[model samples]
Target: MSAEQGTHTHHDDRATVARHAVAADAAALDQAQRTASPIAGRAAGAPSGLDAAYATQHALIARRTDRGERVVGVKLGFTSRAKAEQMGVADVILGTLTDAMGVDDHGRYDPRTAIHPRVEPEVAYLLGPGVEDELAEPDPSASIAAVAPALEVIDSRYRDFRFSLDDVVADNASAAAFAIGPWRRPADTGPMDNRAVSLEFDGRLVQAGSTAAILGDPGRAIAAARRLAGRHGFALRAGMILLAGAATAAVPLPATGVVGAEIAGLGRVSLRVGDGARTEAR
Candidate 1:
């Protein structure tokens, strides 16, 4: 055969190898999920589970993509030092985007679909412009413009609501759904400044926290998010929602309960959890 023909054959072989690698990764993840067995970096005493977690998230994203779902954006979690400590980790993790994760402003969420669902009050940022460059410069302010108060609903498929950092990472940081509030434009305020927030369940106050709880300032969490995305060759884009991690510990959502969050400068967002709806455990 001619040299061009040999090159084509080599290319085909490489493509086949790549396909098998991807298939093997997917099969491993499927086995892990089914048997509740930790794989790769998720194993006990692993330094961090970021790799294993990202792999699993990528698998899920690929599956969604195969089903024709558009990826809207990414979400960051565990930015709060307190939360990291609570989860026994130092850094944050990322989750893939999906249309189904969006909840209507006043919609009801069922608790049956989630393995273990939990609620966290947070401040989310909607990128008005693309941050492709800023994601690499090691500073978050250059890429972000506005911020908003929001809540993240997280759930993990693992049993007992307990898992190692790698396990959680492999599980997409336990992110299930999110509810966002009105945008606080021109987030010129310092990224590290503290802002008070209150959460109410069924019209009664249940918890209160400060944005400072999240990596000293919610903006820093945004910066961390940008950095994390950069590591994965992705950028925070315009109109994409960036969840700056939870401001306080996540709360367990019981079936048939109404949840509300009020950020000092940002407005309020509320949602109802219904029976048969799935939720993450705190």
Candidate 2:
């Protein structure tokens, strides 16, 4: 083929690949939205297929980012060894952040938009300043200095609460929406390495755990978030809220329930989950 023809062919090939990637991403999002279980591989009988389902997830986040959606922060998942082993995965996964997914210190949420929704007691951190690329190493102290305590509300869009590691990763680490508590400055506490936490449902203690539940320390989770963001060509910014992985197994909320979580140093955040009810800020 002539030079001009070769150039045109290359451009066409690039376009075709881009189109396929976008289509795959959209289909994955649709499956999550519809609560449909995506085929494990390309086909029912096919042995080897897509190796990384989260690639489609990354594409979905990219599309949103391209559309001027600011990434508020990152979320860490599968931090506990027990949870990781149960999920049949060795390492944890990360998810991107969006403004629309955030809830105030005292806010409410609807259950209709989520599939297999559950609430996890966690310690969230708010970054004080942006962490640039060069300084993105896994420094727990520096990362912790940029963190604050809060809670996270997670809801999966998977059918029957069933999914493989790839499936969950593609579903944004099963994150639908999250709620933050009153921010507690890291400096206020002296060496909060392994503090204990408790979660109460309707004024009754439901679950208890420690910061050590998250990779020995919540700071490590923050470091993981930093590394993950850097790998994705992004940086953790000031005012960003990072939901460290769950301190304990997620507690499944019934259709109608009042949930509240209390961190050691941080204040408490409460929310009401209901079916077909609008979320009212408390």
Output the number of the lDDT-best candidate: 1
Q: Candidate 2: TM-score?
A: 0.80
Candidate 1, poorest ten consecutive residues by summed lDDT:
40-49
lDDT of 2 at 193: 56
The per-model lDDT (C-alpha) reads 0.69, 0.67
lDDT score, residue 203, model 2?
A: 72
Best candidate (score: TM-score)? 2
Clashes of 2: 0
lDDT of 1 by residue, 1-282 (tens): 999999999999876765555445555544554354545433332223355456556765676678676777778877877667887787778776567777765567776666557888888876655466652553566556677777788876565677777666656667778887766665544444588888878777788988888777777766677778767545467778788777777888767777888877667787778964333222
Q: Give candidate 1's TM-score.
A: 0.78
